[model samples]
Target: MEETMSTRRRQFKADARQLLDRNFRFYLLLFLPIFIIMIVTAVPQWMNGAGVDNPGYNLLSLLSIISGLLTVGVSFVLIDLQRGVAELTEPVSKSFTIFNRGAYLWGAFALEIITSVFTILWSVLLLVPGIIKGLAYSQAIYIYRDYLDQGHKIGFLEAITLSRKMMDGHKWEYFVMQLSFIGWGIACVLIIPIIWVVPYMNQTMANFYVNLAAQEDESDEEPTVVSPVDDADQSTTESKPETPADGDEKTADNDDKTE
Candidate 1:
């Protein structure tokens, strides 16, 4: 059991290191385009509407909304890339690069957009429900990486189903793990040109999912043993047995003594 746990820790570390190394470039590649797009669309409008006469400040307000929307969308893409990093790195090389860039981006965007709409509505009820829904749908990227990348069309329902199954008995554990990263997140929000919190958060969550998936696989591979009888029956079977020869000899001795 100790050995099993140690091996798991090692695997987790390896996966994490690999994610960090690859994600440095992956997130850069992901965010650059989105950032450029957001800036190009958002900045001018925001600056133009900073006038005091602009009562509603439509441009600034709209730019903020647009920026937020872009951030969320870009985040989904980044998370998707992190989820697929393992598979992406499988074929990495100097001369040849990875593929599925388009599929990964678009699929994540679509799913996230759909789920975000649900989250928007869900968020209306109460803040807690929104957070719960966010966490529940958090595995969308992992689901896409594992299932959808293999040419499978696993839809929203399957994604939720698989995530729930993987999360069973481990939800609070994940929540706590997420909580542990809050400090890192806050620190990132304070720093500039050191933006790693998003990637870190995404990869950490992916790592957690990977761990859970590995556990489920191990459990499925292991065969479980079940006993048909009670402990008393087991004890009886394990007890010493009398030999036929010994029993006969005892009986003969008794008869002779009687004679």
Candidate 2:
């Protein structure tokens, strides 16, 4: 059965909690790449002292893009980890290697560029367009990761295209789903809980992708809906006993009295 989004979300939270309770360390290992990437991405800006008069990341355009791409690559691996393909049972040493795979890494880099360009283009039109586009492109990361993991050669734009299709009629729902996380996000600002929050959020998102994929499969099946009119028509076609006419009944009664 296809679950309502709210039901799926509640299940996702329960799953995340179970994952955390069973092995916090392993989940933390999954989130390590994201934390490291974030710090690395921030360092250059910090060194340049953004508050100063000439404040900006003191890096070449190419390097800055590479940094952003690397962050995206790590994020892809994090998704893979939550999906359990990255091998949770192994040592923490193995956790960091998933993102380093050449195909997933390069694919993420290209996917990030394509989505960002289009998102920025939409933003130029109006803020709402940009937000909607961002939601539309949200699934690209997971699509790319899944493609690479399956040992297929996927083009950069194809993943984004597939994501747009998968997200059709789903953008606003996705937006609201993310909005529901705002409370947890605010809690993460306290620093200590961030480690746990990050992994939980990652796990929830991966589960969401799984649900989305399943829903797509169900849609492809084209489930049938039975209408009331169809039921009435079918009932009328069934065999039934005929009733005696009024004149035939009166004649039979008179004949019985004479006998």
RMSD of every candidate to native, in Å, equals 20.7, 20.3
lDDT of 2 by residue, 1-259 (tens): 1256677678877886786778888767655655665667567666657654433445445555654554455454444455555555653444444356777566666667777887787788777666777777788766666645544455556666556666776666666667878898998886548788776776677666666755654564321111222232433322211222433311212211110
- What is the per-residue lDDT of model 1 for residues 1-259, given as tens digits with 9 covering 90 to 100? 4455446445544565576576567555544544555556655657657852444456655655545444544443434443453233321221111123656545555667766775676678867666565566666555654554344455555565455455555555556666766676667658634345555555555556655655654574321111121221433222211212322311212111100
lDDT of 2 at 162: 59
Give the clashing residue pairs of candidate 2, or none.
Answer: none
lDDT top scorer: 2
lDDT for 109 (candidate 2): 63
TM-score of each: 0.52, 0.68
At residue 194, candidate 1 shows an lDDT of: 38
- Those runs of model 2 whose alpha carbons end farther than 4 Å from true positions after fitting are 1-3, 36-56, 59-86, 91-99, 221-259
Best-performing candidate as measured by TM-score: 2
